[model samples]
Target: MTTISTVDATKFKHVSYLWDDAKAAALAGDEVALFIYRSNMLGADLRLTNYGGGNTSVKLKDVDPLTGQETDIMWIKGSGGDIGTLKKSGCAALYVDRLRSLENVYRGIEFEDEMVALFNHCIFDLDSKAPSIDTPLHGFLPFAHIDHLHPDAAIAIAAAKDGQKITEELFNGEIGWVGWQRPGFDLGLQLRACLEEAAAKGIKLRGIMLGSHGLFTWGDTAYESYINTLEVIEKCAEYLESNYGKSRPVFGGAKIDSLPEADRKLQAAKVAPILRGFCSSERQMIGHFTDDVRVLEFINSNDLEKLAPLGTSCPDHFLRTKISPLVLELAPSEDLSDVAGIKAKLTPAFEAYRAMYTEYYNTCKHDNSPAMRDPNPVVILYPGVGMFTFAKDKTTARLASEYYINAVNVMKGAEAVSEYTSLPRQEAFDIEYWLLEEAKLQRMPKPKALSGRVALVTGSAGGIGKAIAKKFAEEGACVIINDINEERLDGAKAEFVQIFGKDAVASTLLNVTDAASTEQALDNACLAFGGVDIVINNAGISISKSIADHSLEEWDRLYDILVKGQFIVSKAGIEVMRKQGFGGDIVNIVSKNAVVAGPNNPGYGSAKAAQAHLTRLMAAELGADKIRVNTVNPDAVISDSNIWAGGWAEGRAKAYGITVAELPAYYAKRTLLNEIILPVDIANACFAFVGGLLGKSTGNALNVDGGVAMGFYR
Candidate 1:
């Protein structure tokens, strides 16, 4: 019998042990629940495994629904599911007897991929998710519970030059070793053969380590399996730490120094848009920027040039980060404030990287391989700056950078003790463009209309501005919500963060009338989500007074927020959009009063007229750059309107000789359609202008006022 030892809590420094006895006890007797519990614990720590990187399994006996008899069943994580967020529905249930019977008709290694289709016939539950490619590996294992993890400490040893010899000494012959092979039926057979050979030599092996791969551990019970995995990982980490402490001047010492925090942010802002433009040559992509300590350390190292070209050793790391990264050729001490000079140098670097990737596809692609994907690099490294990652959305871009950081840790540990080895070019290409992987990609849901776009909506804390921001987020756009009211801004941001996630929303206190505040707000948008693609000039104030009663101060205040404020925000947003080299949308929230000659509304009406004309002027001037400028004319949007809340309702009621409670009915009666307009009506008009429906139309005015005939454009 294989001995399972409990790992001492004090022995673990690199990874945490988070198993609670009470939590496990509450989940006893149900094997699937215990399996999910154990998987979540292991996946909670980044030091143990990355997102969607590993697999776990448990075998149990259950009554067959059709046969009315107890039968063996295997439940494992399905393909494309993250272990950290695994649920009961995410597990794929297969008949163990039928799964193991495939060995009788198995052809040679050349026909291993054909075995994947056979696993479908062994499904015990018709509603179970599709089984992962590693299904057979768990099905053929002799243990009742198993865990195959890709921890950094274990991979560091697995990727070293003398990994096999080191594994023999580290576990004292209790663990076995297997050479590199792509995961499939053949790899499962190799694992089974290694276990048999160990038993033949009178050895009770606890686990096995695969070269240039990861670790495998098992036990008779769920708790035993969890503890055994922790023990093996802790031992590997302790050994690596001892050897790494003795080796100083790691990565051959840093060759460059990192920039100061403020300066680094400034440089990153300047370069991120340029990089985003180059990456979006094929399709629009969202970008993420980070100056993490480990990323900066790797960027400043001397061995970066040598090691980065070799790419990542683990399959999970390369799948997200691509086979390799594009390193910018710039000295740490170079003047980074020169935006034009940086773009000039980056042009050739990006061109060269694309050419190299195209060649790689041409050399390694099989006849039936999936077509070459976007040739742009997913990850980019700057010598003095940090790292930049691009993808179809913000979360994926951030995860790609995180996976690359994990690869950096593996490289650091491997180089400390022995030479670090990456997977060969052919093997890396084979896994990246595999047919099964292509099928999985095809199964992903269609992207939303505004999937990779970013929007900046002023005064978004309440009223029409808030509604517009929510709509943008629902359509897959990242939103930067800004307002002058701190209390409302915080509340609005919290609501959006809860619904759309933190990655999709950012908040800033902005006074659009102030030039400095306006520019800084735009800068915040760029830093939050690479650059701004949509700008909604919705911040405003209202005063319903005739020319004789309106003081000069009242007129100035109205013009400052409604007219000049729009100008300041649009001018700043244009600068950033031009830098991104992509067209954008500017939707000015002008009122229907701009076109109507109404009584007791001189100050508000005149300022809105100026804003309306500004939209047309900007549209005519910016058409060459493809930036569309349009106006949304909304009337009597009383519900949740900040303008109405600030004494505007009483003023309008007084002007019409009616009580404040009768304002909604009065406004509705004035419209041709007899309909009461709401904030969502205004929001829908804004979406129609910027939501790609009117992509070819610019310098347009859309009215959402229930057909106000007098306010119609001439």
Candidate 2:
């Protein structure tokens, strides 16, 4: 059954191809650089290509150093290359002649690994990165440069029922159409045949339109290929917008007739956390929402579940996003006006969604098939609330969100000209469970231990605290940098945001001893991310004094900042974790003096000891909730501390009858390891505790003092 959308191609100006820039760079004789520049120029536009979803190649001249022979190798963007920042290292140089060896072989229903091994075997340089799965398509083409991408506009038209006929009419024989097939041996041979067939018919081929997959554009120069890509894509965009669209929603949902925009966005936020819980994998889920008018409208469309069943807009997205999003049956907005109300109403809906997913898998699986994937829903559509996406980690959650937003946009665009035509259920299964895609997943590096977790590090404005926060970020955790010093806190936030990116870092001013301040900070952290999973107790200050000389104020301050503050923060954090229904971690930073006190530091030592004991009690109590509590006690780290930077170090050194600079050496010489215990050492111990290295460890203390004689643990 075919349907028609009244939008037709109207004259829209061509977005000029970056030919001038490419020409200038090529004239300077840097062809490889030209390839990267052209690829990035196209890739930077999300409408043209998505993250990690495109490949580009250029034929580079190579001189054999050992044989003095001249040959050519095509340096193509490799498997893991992200073209946005692609450079020389992102490419794999494959010998063109070696790649031709597997051209005509008959592959009879083979595994994707065999083809991948063949591609790996054809590498011209021993140390070059592995070629991408689509390398053969680029190599077989004689053009000097090739660009392949899954542009939404191009794919929207390619997935329409009038696909090939409309493509021929639009490009006027400039683009060749290749029907959908899993990318491998057969696709490569057919790609070459498609171009040859077009050329033999006296047609000038500019690019290849892959049915239900993507597009491939080629040229004698990088500029020509990149420009052809932009021109054809622009053509598709104009055709959809000018002819069929009466007026598209900002993204692709039906406009909410009853709710105001603010109310709709509010409703989406209220529903986000509930869905996050329902869609969580082994790790808790992170939810991201977008009420792009189009998406909001799409979800509000009459019978959204029926419409969403149209399947993935493009096959490239099948792995990250399943064939169709799980559209939960939402209740009326008035019944679920608040967050708590919505969560309660949606609880049963989530259970039903999972049950259906299991049923779908059972019906789809063969006896020899692999086990079903995690039953958690990755994509969800709801009425009035827009679309929400979930994943085990924040970045994946964000990607899933944007992917669906674009998908809805593309599906609507296709509908503007013709109905959204999708792949058959079996075809979707073939791609989703395809050995090649699975192999790609197997080859990927394991995610960081804390990849999806949220960590809040107190006193992170400097030294030990900053190091711990950095370690968490490196392990893929979203970190919150908390501190009391405004200047230092802002500076640390800027540096962390620069290093780890915007969403991965957040900052808050927290006075650990104040209950209201602690609660406020926790609220902000929860608001930024749906919940807090890990909290680090690192803020402390100590004054050197004899027990008799210690003032009441000095004792109170030590206890307040070091002990009471932790209790306040922990109380607030535990509440959030319990509400989220996931276990968490609390790491307290104590001192070696907790076990072995030095003279004149009675107040500081006692406070630390109390903090350590408190850690044990919390660990024992919270274990049932899945929250782990631990402590890292270190000897003097004055050389690696922000707290010790002022009068404390000077006063301590004076008491020892030595200069302040000699304090680090004094501590180092007393330790058996004779090492300067840096802040990172403490951070590593904390990682061992909360980073899942010692999952069985709780109610324990790890000494990171480099084996101090007095601080030695049995």
Candidate 3:
């Protein structure tokens, strides 16, 4: 057993409280605000605790309506609150006596709904937030302040095989212990009983350690309880350090050489997009990577199978990480960078993972028979390649990754002290299938229109291109903006930041007419965001000339920008998308003039005609690969656009026998709907194709000339 020999207080943080901050909080007028501030200080350190893993409570005087007397009421961290970013409204208040009275009735009640019904009735103010599920424990303890957390260092001791014995030694007889029991009414009663027994012995306890769970500390002020938590956790950390904390062997049993650091990252990069595409569900998959040495040690070990079946260190992790991570095996011939090789291994591995998950779910869910969710792996492991976690969104993916990082650390620490341990598999199942947790999942916000997808928009510096790029980004797609205009491209990047934030937008200069330049630009898009799933081929330039007057050079230049540009970008984009094995879109912004003939526009119309025919040809050939190629023929957009800013619009207005300012109304009145075709209107038309609204219809031209009679399909 491990025992703490001396109290060296200097090892812990000493600045959670300052007089100036406390006074300012008080003077600023809200007491709950003060708790929020203090809670953040405690949660700021991951070594101390994680978001939603701890609760803090403060007791304050309030008038009891029935008795007309002042009594103490409790304000504790609410169930939905994150201590790291708690607000004044995030605290839940409950009457002390009212909460304690339910403990007996709660003792046998294991269902969250039943307890929640009772808690709702007992809310101190009736208008405050719902109290935490651990409310009973905090309420029964007759303390002015209480803080409960599962700090990594402290729980490292609590999760060991001889956790209770080690905790006794670490506390040096200064703390009380409660035996292992699932939290709820029974555990609360047990903690209260232990306190009563300690009082009978004339020993005033400052803290209590719950075996295989966490720790609790209470005091006269927020600062007292907070500091007590820090000191006790430090003692446990020191105890572990003195024992077997140095140079611990990790990575369950297998031994494999970790790839060179640079190779490791490159491998991750190669497989990340494939992993993203393997998800068969409508909800897109987003990936997160971990390379911490402890994680590396565990994944690289030969005995991965031996460690995986033990389950998570805490049941709370079941909500984010599930029970255990799925392990992926690498073969001798399959290198991470080889697209076909990576996919060959992952394709079967993915199917096997889902099959195993399905078996686990069916075995555990005989009675409830709830609708089964898609069997997607939250955590995936490859021994030498590293660990990758997948989630429906970036935030959830990051959370699952962080939890596993902490998990390996805690598991490692417990292994050093004794045999590492986790709660029973059935216990984890209970938490994972808990109705309350299920309800939380049901309440998760709907995925955004373009969630977990990426789009590349060329010619996106201004006008129609910028509108399309902004639209894609607004719908939650990661966007790569490309344009030939460098200054305007930089300007678009800044404006996009104001609209979409920096993470969603990546900008690069693209010369669409040059095959090599276009290939590099599209490749940049894949690197910027895993892979490109949407390609908007909107880049073009126009030249006005009659057939006889058009010189060979002018005709060549016009075709290069209008027809060949679309081909070059689309070709490169499809290479990446096809390797990804995910169906994608290529939206060619052809003009209405492609189908309608006009005077003095022979070169421009001919190039547009060629691009339109090219779209149908590609769609026919690539449909087998699941790629949908479509064209939107927008007639005339009258808003501020590069083509119309000076040269093209002025010349077109003169051709129409109207002033530049009157040309919009001239074009608008000519259309059936008599509507102005703004750049956004064209963008909306293009977005329709990209967003899958035209799912079953592709290889077709949708004329966006406000119902042109001549352009309508016969």
Best by TM-score: 1
Give the per-residue lDDT of model 1 (tens digit) for 397-511: 9899889998998898899888899999999999899888898899889998899999999999999999999999999999999999899899999999999999899899899
Clashes in each model (backbone N, CA, C under 3 Å)? 0, 11, 7
Root mean square deviation (Cα) for candidate 3: 4.8
- Report the lDDT tens digits of candidate 3 across residue range 1-714: 111224244556522322234454463545455556667777777777666787888777888888999987888888877777776687888888888888656536545347766877678776687776788778878887787877777777788888878876766656888866666656777888889898898878878888767788876765556667777877777766665535455434448877877667666655666776776354666666766677788887765677766767665565678777877777322455577877886788778877877787777774764566668778877677677787765556667877777677677678777877887766666677767767777887876788877788889998888888888888878888978989989998999988877667788899999988886676556445556788888887766655787789988988898888988989988877877777888999998889888777888898999999999999999998888999988878767566664266766775677888888788889899998787787788777887867867679878888877777665
The candidate with the higher lDDT, 2 or 3, is 2
**Clashing pairs for predicted structure model 1, backbone only:** none
Candidate 2 lDDT over residue span 1-714, tens digit each: 111122122322533333354355554577888888888877777887778787899987787555779877889888877786787788898888778777655465455447778887678777787787788888888889898988788888888877888889988878899998877766877889998998889987889998877899877776667766777888888877775546543334443453676666555544454555556645666656666776766777753655687767576676677767877666536554354665676677667766876776777776655667777778887766667677766677777777776677677667777667777776777667766667667887888889778888889889899999999999888888988889989999999988988878888998999998887777666545556789999998978788898889999999999999889988878876765666889999998888986777888889999999999999989999898899999877865687685467876787678898798898788788888898899888889898787887888888988787777665
lDDT values, one for every candidate: 0.89, 0.77, 0.75
Write out the backbone clash pairs for model 3: 251-297, 251-298, 253-302, 253-303, 254-301, 254-302, 254-303
lDDT of 1: 0.89
Answer with 1 or 3, whichever has the higher lDDT. 1
State the weakest 10-residue window (summed lDDT) of model 3. 1-10
Q: What is the TM-score of each candidate against the true structure?
A: 0.97, 0.83, 0.85
